[model samples]
Every structure is written in structure tokens, then in C-alpha cells.
Target: MIDQLSLTNFKAFRSADIPLAPVTLLTGLNSSGKSSVLQAFVLLRQSYDSSTLFSSGGGLLLNGELVELGTGLDVLHEDVVHTPGLPTPLISIGLRTSEGQNFNWSALYAAEQDVLTLHSASDAQRTKSVFDRRRFQYLKADRIAPATSYPKSHHQAIGLGFLGASGEHTVNYLRHHARRPLTSKPLRHPKAQTNNFLDHVVAWMQELCPGVNLEATEIPGIDAVRLSYGFDGTAGLTSSARRRPTNVGFGLTYALPIVVACLSAGPGSLILLENPEAHLHPRGQSRMATLMAAAAAAGAQLIVETHSDHVLNGLRLAVKNGAMSATDTAVHYFRRRGLQAEIVTPRIHEDGSLSDWPEGFFDEWENSLEQLLD
Candidate 1:
């Protein structure tokens, strides 16, 4: 797990050290640099995957499988200070892992170039960073919507265990690894019919929508897999009548990858999720946070970017319930200051209380309530 991430002249941050934990939540108003924090990790992960970071003359791959950050001009901080002797300001990304390994990658800024040349010598012999590990998942804000069938990629889903940046490979992964054994007891759902991975997935997904069971199967003779849902009772749809993902509500299809990713997480796995509460109701949003907390407790590292206070409260609830220690969680509130981003981190006490409540930190509920009362 990465203990801290340092950014210099990268995106909205001129210089900042973002503290990380087993579970770190990045929350703030839109456009306040929350996504940028997750992008940094994906940038490195994609760059390494493309072999550009480890090659002899590797640089940052601006567009890749994980992220498609534009040229250096678009990513460089707007108010980056140019040194007197240096022709170009260097954008650096540093990471300190929990094992105390420090990895720094600095690139020379090129206004129009997508791939920025590394300022330091490229060395592939160094130990692997958590980002380079195979057990990683990055789900972007814009994910796959309701579809008849999702593409099946054996190399991506089975070979790498990646659900894709947009979670497009999730169905394929589910079809391939459905029966795999779960490694952690905390992640197991008591109501699950079996201890297999698929049942556990169905059980937790019921939290989002009760009695919802799903199936993932390969669409023969094609590079696609199908997903369908069945409800338990004689309600909208019965268990005998399986409905395609297109017929199912958008929320279930939208939240499926998230639930699968959390269930699949284990020790040394790094999961980065953006807006895990996209289409779910308030209670379901909070339950998603519980899933994330359970993932952390099971030894995976999760860095989540969310705007829902319900998700925040759910994490607090998880802590209060002793699912995870307060020390394992870090909450960051990002706000814009001039042309750069500033972060205010509030500590979580053992009782699930926060060390401080900054003005704009999930205070909208209180603000609206006060207005209503007045």
C-alpha cells in the first residue's frame, strides 16, 4: 500500500503531500482536484503497464489504458514557477509505500508533447511499486452503462484481474472468476448460499437492491459476455425469469463492477474508485462505503473519491462498528485556493468522530437544515 503521495506542479497541485491509509476518502466540491489525486496513481500504473516507465528512454504515457490525460500543458499546474536556470519546470510524482520504499518519477515539461521525457535515469530493476502489482483496479467516473453484452478479454480479465478503467471488463472477469474462493472472512456475506465468489457478490449486491441475483455467461462465438439479473419473489421479475442487464435498472449495472472489485480485493491489492455512489440511493451509497471499509479490513488498500455524504457516514459507521480502525482511514477535504488545490485532512477518532469539521466538509446537510428551520 502507498503511505503517501507527493505531487509537484502536477495538475491542480503545485506542491502537496497527500497522506494515505488503508482506506482514504477524497471529498470536496467539484473541480477541486479530487480526481487529480486518483489520476496520479493511474498515470503511473498505465505508464508502467505500457513499459514506458521502465524502458531505457521511457517517459509518462499521456494516453493509455488507465487514463487519457492530455499533453503536458493540460496537466502542468497553471501557476508553475519556472526556475532561473532550468529551461522547463519539472513535474514530479513521488510515492512512499507502506514498506518504506520511495519511488520518484520526474518528467521534463513539454507544452505540446504527450510523453514527457524522464529527468532521472530509467531503471526497471527496482522493486515493484504497489501500482505495478497485478492485483489492481481503477474504476473511472464515466463507466459502462446498461448494455446487452460487454466485451470479453481473457488477457485483461483473467490474465491481469483488471476490471478496466471504465469497468468495461467486469462481466468477463465475473464469468471467469465466479467460483474462485474468497481469501478473507470479513468479506464473506453470511447470507450467501455458498462461499464461492459469485454468491458472495450476489449477497452484497442485495444490499443495493434486495433479492437481486446476477449471472455472467459468455456469448458463444464472440468476444463478449452477458449479464442478467433475477429477483427472488413474484415482484417485478421472478428468479425463473432472467432479465438482461439492459432490462435491469441502471443502478445495478452501474454498481456491479464496484461490488465485484471490492469483493475481489485482498492483501496487496490496490483499488481506486471514483464516485462509487453514482446511481444508487442514499442507503445504498452508504452500503458501498461499508464494502470499501470491509475491503480495507481484509487487507486491501482503497482510495476513493466521492461527493456523497451518505458514503462518508457509512465509512464512519464502519469505523464505529469496529470493522476497521480509525487509524486506517484518512479523510481529505479539497478546496481551491487561487490557482492551486489545498487539502484539509480531518482525523477520525476511535468512536467514529472527526477531529474537526471544516466549513465545506460535508456540511451541506446541516446548512440546508438550518435554512429550512429558519
Candidate 2:
């Protein structure tokens, strides 16, 4: 897992080094650079996946499947700080591993070009463990909504075991790997019908909506799969009439990939989630946090971006409940200072209490109460 991420003259950061943990939570207000941090991971993943980063004449591809960060002018820090000894001002991204290996990439700035040429060391010699691995998932915030059918990509769903950046291939993945055994004990759902992947997925989805069961079936002669949900009592009473995603509320399908991503996690996997709590209720959001912690305990490294306070409290609850060690979790509260983004990290104790609560850091409830009382 990445121990730290350093940004030099990157978007919204002149120079910043953010510490990472087994489970890292990035929370802050709008446009405070939280998404930018996650974008860096996707950027690297995109470069590596396209085989450009590993080639001799390789560089950063600004537009790719994982992320579409525009030209150099858009990504270059507004007020760039140059290295004292370097002749040119360049954009550098450095990733340091827990085992003390460093991977640094520096790109020359072009005003309107999408691809930034590399000015740094050989990408072949650098450690590409996290970005190059197959067990990686990056779910974007603007994910797929309620749809009648989702596309099926054999290479992505079967060969790569990828659920897609927007989880567009999730139904196909489920249809193919439903019966696969869940090896991770912590991620297994006790109430699940079997030890199979699909069963565990249904059991966890039931947490969001009670008695809810789902199935993914391949459409005949089509490169697509369909998802259908049915309640327990309704299945027996109404001759097993299933409900499409459009009929059910938005939360279940929206959160499906998150559940699958967490369940699929294992040792050496890296999962990056953007707004995992989107379209879910407060309780569902909290449950998502617990699942994230459980994934960490099961040996996967998760980096989550969320704005929900319930998610924060649920992480604290997980630490207190012994699901994961407090020391293994890191919470970063981001806020904009002038033109740059500054981060303030609050420590979590064994008791699930925070060392400090900065202003605008999930304190809206207390602030509103104070106003009402006054």
C-alpha cells in the first residue's frame, strides 16, 4: 500500500505530502482538493494501464479511461513552486511505499497539450505494485444510475475481474463469478444462503433494504446483463415477480458496486471509493463505513472520499468495536487556503474519539444546534 503521496505543482497543490493508512478517509468541503488526491491515483493507473508509463518514451496521458484531466495548463498548479536546482518548473508526483520504496514521476508542462512528456527517471525500474496490479478498483462519484441493463465486457469482468470505473460491468461480473467462494472470512456475511460470492452480495444488500434479494442474468445473444431485485415475501406471494432497478429506489443499484468491491477485496488489493455513501440513507452510509473497515481488516487497502458525517461516526464506531485498529485508520480534513489546498489530520483514539475537530469538519449538526439554542 502507499504510505504517502506527495504532490509538487499539481492541481490545487503547490507542494503537499498526504499520509496514507490501511483505511484512509478523505473528507472536506467542495473543491478542497479531496477529489484531486484520488484523481492522482487514477491518473497513474491510467498511464500504466495504457502501457505508456512503462515504455521508454512514456509520459502521463491526461485523457484516459480512468481519468480525463485536461491539458497541462489545467493541471499545473496556478502558483507553481520550482525546485531550487532544476532549470525548469515541472509537475511531479511521488508515491512512497510502506517498505520505503519511492516512485516519482515528473512531467514537463505544455500549455495546451493533453499528454505531458516525462522529464524524470525510467518507469521500468520504478515499483508499480499498486498501480500495475489486477486487484485494483477505482469507483468514481458519478457512477451509473438505475438502468434496465448493464454492459458485459469479457475482458474486464472475467479476465481482469474489474467492475469498471462506474461499475458498468458489475452485472456481468456477478453473472460470471456468482458462485465463486469468498475466501475472506471477515467479509463473509453470516446470514448469507451460502459461502458463494453472489449469496454474500445479497446478504449485504439486504442490510440496505430488508428481505431484498437480487440476481444477475445474461441477456440472450446480447453483450449485456440484467439485474433484478425481489423481496422475500413478495417472491412467494406474487409468483416471484422481480423488480427492475428502475422500480426500486436508487440506493440499492447505486451502492451495489461498493458492496461488490468491498467483498472482492483481499490481501494486496487497492480500492479507491468516491462518495460511497451517495444515494444511501444515514444507516446505510454508516454500514458502508463498517464494510470498509472490515475490508481493511481482511487485508485490502481502501482510500475513501466522503462528505457524510454518518460515515465518519461509523468509522469511529468500528475502531471502538475492535473491527480495526485506530492506528491503522487516517482521517484527513481538507480545506482551501488561498489558492492551495491544506489538510489537517485528526487522530483517532482507541475509544473512537477524535483528537481534534476542526471547523467545517462534519460539525454542521452542532453548529445548527447552537444557532437554534441561541
Candidate 3:
């Protein structure tokens, strides 16, 4: 997996080298560059998927399916650095693997152009291994809400195994892969009856809303799929009828893609999540963290951006509970200094306690209590 990501003259970072682990949690205030890190991964993968990064006229496509970064000027660091005589500073992105191999891509700056031409290298093997759509999944913060039907793209869902950046194809993908065996023991929810993917999903969702179960089915004569939810003994109901996603409310449908993504984990899988805790209750958010840790223990590498302390505490709980090795996790607290983003890394101990907690790093609860007492 990506052991480290280096950004030079990229958005929100003049120069930054961010370390990654089996499960890396990016947490910080709004606009503090947490999402920018995930965007870089999507940017590279999007460029590669469109064949723009490796073609003869190589370039980084700023606007693509996964992200829309606009012109080079929009992403170029305001305080760009360059050689004394150089008029322009190139935007460079570097990915270093755990095996010590480095894949670098640099693009020339253009004021208004969307595609920035690149100075490419023949590191195709390593690059493909990192960005190949089949092994990668990116779920954006603005995910698909409750919908009657979701798009079904065979190439994206079944062929590439992508749930889509906004999870627009999740229903279709879920329907197609429902029966697939979940061989990752760590990812299999204990309460799940069967070893199939769908049952595991229900068992996980049941944590948020007890007795909640969902299904994805194809719509005949259309290139779409529908997702529905049902409850058993929830709110004193014996067995509720399958209802459209619209009727079940936002949290369940909104969190479905994340559940499916984590369950899809396996050796060499790379999942980039933006706010996996969004719209979730306190307990649900924390449970999401445990689910992610399980994904890491199952051999997938996950880079998650979240703002919930419950998610943070859940991760600590996982480490302490032996769900994953403490060494396998990294907690980064991000905050802006002037115009650039600064990151502080805290080590996770065997006891699930942090080695450091910088100011404004998930300390609001205590901070607020102090004020209340005063």
C-alpha cells in the first residue's frame, strides 16, 4: 500500500510528506487539508483511468469522474517554491511504497488550463499496482442520498468492482456481488448468519439500527438497480415490509456504501474514505471505526478522513481490544498554519492510548466540560 504521500506545490500544502499505515485516520478542522490528501489519491487514479497520465502527451486531468480540481492555478500552492531563476514551479506528487519503490509524477503549471502536462517516467508497473481501479475505491464526502434507484454500469460495478465516487453504483454493485463469499475472517460480522457479503452487510448495519436489513435488486428493462430496507422487531414491529431507500431515512442509505466498501476488503485493497462517520449517531460512528480496523486486519489498507471523536475513540478501543496491532494504525491531527497545512502524528500505544494530543485534537469534549465547570 502507499506507505507515504509527498506533495510539492499542491493544494493546501507547499511541501508535505504524510506517513501512512495499514489504517490511517486523518482528522482536523474544516478546510485544514484532510480532504485534500484524499483528493490527491483520487487525482492520480482519475488521471490514470482516463489514460492521460501515461499517454505520449501526458498530463494530469484536474477534472474527472472522481474529482474536479479545476485549473492548475486552483490547485497550485499560493506560496510555490522554485529554483531562483525558474519562472514556474512544477506541481509534484510522490508515492513511496512500503517496499521502498517511489513513483513520482510532476506537472507543469498552467494558469487557466485544466490539464497540466506532465514530466512522466516509465514506472508503469508500480504506478498501475497503486492506481488500478480494481484494487482501489474512493467514496467522496457527498455520497448518494436516499434514492429509488441507482445506476448500473457493468464495466464499473461488476468488471472494475467500483462502487463509484459518490456510491452512485452501489445498489447495482451490491446486487451483483451479494452472494460473493466473504473469506476475510476479520471482516465477517460475528452476528451474520451466512458467509456471504450481503448477510455481513446486514449484520453490520444492524449495529446502527437494530433489526435493519437491506437488499439490492435489478429493475427489469432498465440499466439500474434498486435498494430497499426492512426491519425485524425494530420499534416493536414483527417484520416490516421492504421499503424504498427514500422511506428508511438518510443514515442507512448514506452509510451503505461504506459498509460494502469495508466488507470488500482483502489483501492489497486500497480504500480512501471521506467522513465515514457522517450522519451517524455516536455509537454508530464508533462502530464504523471498529469496522474499518477490521478491514485493516483483513489485509486492506484504509485511509479515512473523519471529524468524529467517537470514531477516534472507537479506533482506540479497537487497538486496546486487539482487533489490530497498534503499530498498524496512525492518527494524524491536521491544522493550518498561515496558508499551509501542518500535520501532527500521534503514536498509538498497545493500550490504545495516544502518545500525544496536540491542541484542538479531539479534545473538545474535555475543553467544553472545563468551561461548563468554570
RMSD each, Å: 1.3, 1.6, 1.3
lDDT tens digits, residue span 120-177, model 2: 8435745556564678999999887889999989999889988999988888989998
Tens-digit per-residue lDDT, 1-374, candidate 3: 77999998999999999999999999999999998899888888888999998888788899988899999989999998784555778888889999998989988889899999986554676567777567788999999999898998999899999989998888888898899898989998989989999999999999877889888999999988888888886765545577888887889888999999998877899999998888889999999999999999888999999999899899999999999999899999999999999999989899989998899998889999999999
lDDT against the true structure, per candidate, is 0.90, 0.89, 0.89
What TM-score quantifies how close candidate 3 is to the native fold? 0.97
Write down the TM-score of every candidate: 0.97, 0.97, 0.97
Segments in model 2 whose C-alpha atoms lie over 4 Å from true places: 84-87, 122-126, 234-239
lDDT of 3: 0.89
State the TM-score for model 1: 0.97
| True-structure lDDT of candidate 1 | 0.90
